[model samples]
Target: MDWIDWGDAPTWLGAVFAAAAAGAAVWTLKSQRDQIDEQRRFIAEQSMNLGLERQALLAAAQERHEAQARKIRLYPQAPTYVQVVNDSDDPIYDVHCEARGMPALHAVELAPSEGVGAGILADLVQGASRPYVHRLGVGREAWFHVVTNERGAVHIRFTDAAGNKWVCDDAGGLHEAGA
Candidate 1:
């Protein structure tokens, strides 16, 4: 029996081993890339959730502020006088009352409807203020004309404790007033 020579067999085996090592390195790199992409996706989702939560918190704060503004009430006791009441725990500032036309929804005293406006507060109102009612020929000389009638509503603008300005009407319509 003759033993056959296995020349260069070790070098051939080394080449095969090198190829396998290269393949394993490529697989490891691909796995790492996939993991990085998955992490990026997770981070993006978390950011969007945080943004939505922030928006919800802001909306809730605005609702609470408007609720505080609704505590003020205005009514006409007689033709000569008006009854202004503040039901809230906190005092509101710069309160201005005006009679708006029903059709146009415009304030009658639009000209000086600021600090020196008629039927308005020159100073910060604390609780209840009984001021002289202005003579309005519309709706039987009522300080606050009802929405049920053809006459307009009585609206009041005031500043809240948080420095937010608001405008509310006797008919339950409320909105944020811009500076």
Candidate 2:
């Protein structure tokens, strides 16, 4: 029986096999590196997309919070006067009042708990002859007297600290003007 003679194989044949194995190993390493690079790129793109989505959600939440904080209310105090109240978290400025058959009155500022009174309220009503701008702090009140009694609605205007305009009517309805 004749056995295969590995000992008779040429020395160059062993060198060829070693070279082929080395080439395969290099090819495999390169393929693995390319796959890893592609995965990294995909992960980076996904991360960027997630960040953009998070920013949009945060902006929406901020807008909703600001809307809630800007809420205002007007309340009728009595037969002679009405009160403008800030029902939100922010401060309002440049408060102005206008009623039928009466001159418009301007107020300086009003905070969250602060309010202004229009018409002949109580003794707190300031005289009509003097133009006064009042700054009502939180939970404070200021009054302006009415000189005439006419059968018409009253309207109040003001700006928030953020420069947003607000209006309120005698019907107790409050709205943002020019929004």
Candidate 3:
């Protein structure tokens, strides 16, 4: 405390400090803006990935039952009946066959065909075929229903091996129940 000396203090020191402080502030703001932009890009990329993942899951779910449905076939073997064949390696349950837009059977008795006694077959084993006739006739009810010239005139409803219900149209289009 005896003496204080400031005779050699540099005059430009204060200005240098101010300039450095302003430069540091600008650099910090730029860095913050860059970080924000990167975060936005990352969020957008993740959102797109999530959307793609959802689409893939949906596709897989839809195809799960199609393989079994493809094995169910309806071939028109006669005017009064079509053959129902289960060509798969697994059994299907609750099969139903119906005739739509069918013509009159003038030579045979035409009535509501009880396709396997109740318009429903409890189960059809693999490689089994039945006749399904609608005009007091029969199939592979593993046969039932009549022939029609119209598109999608005959359709089959059944439960697959996995217990999933399905429909096979005359056009051979397969769809899951309630879809």
Using TM-score, give the best candidate's number.
3
Give candidate 2 misplaced runs (Cα > 4 Å). Answer: 1-70, 104-134, 147-152
Ranking by TM-score: 3, 1, 2
Off by over 4 Å in 3: 1-12, 101-141, 145-151
For each candidate, C-alpha RMSD in Å?
10.3, 6.9, 9.5
TM-score, cand. 3: 0.63
Model 1, 25-78: lDDT tens digits are 999999999999999999999999999999999999867867767776655433
Indicate which candidate wins on lDDT. 3
Cα lDDT of model 2 by residue, 1-179, tens digit: 36756765676688899999999999999999999999999999999999999999999976764563346555544555555665556555656566674644422333434334333332344433333334334443334344432334676677766666666676656577875
Candidate 3 or 2, higher lDDT:
3
Clash counts for the predictions, in order: 0, 3, 21
**How many angstroms is residue 113 displaced in model 2 relative to the true structure, after the best TM-score fit?**
11
Give the Å shift of residue 86 in candidate 2: 2.4
* Residue 138 shift from truth in candidate 2, angstroms: 2.5
Compared with the true structure, all predictions reach lDDT values of: 0.53, 0.57, 0.59
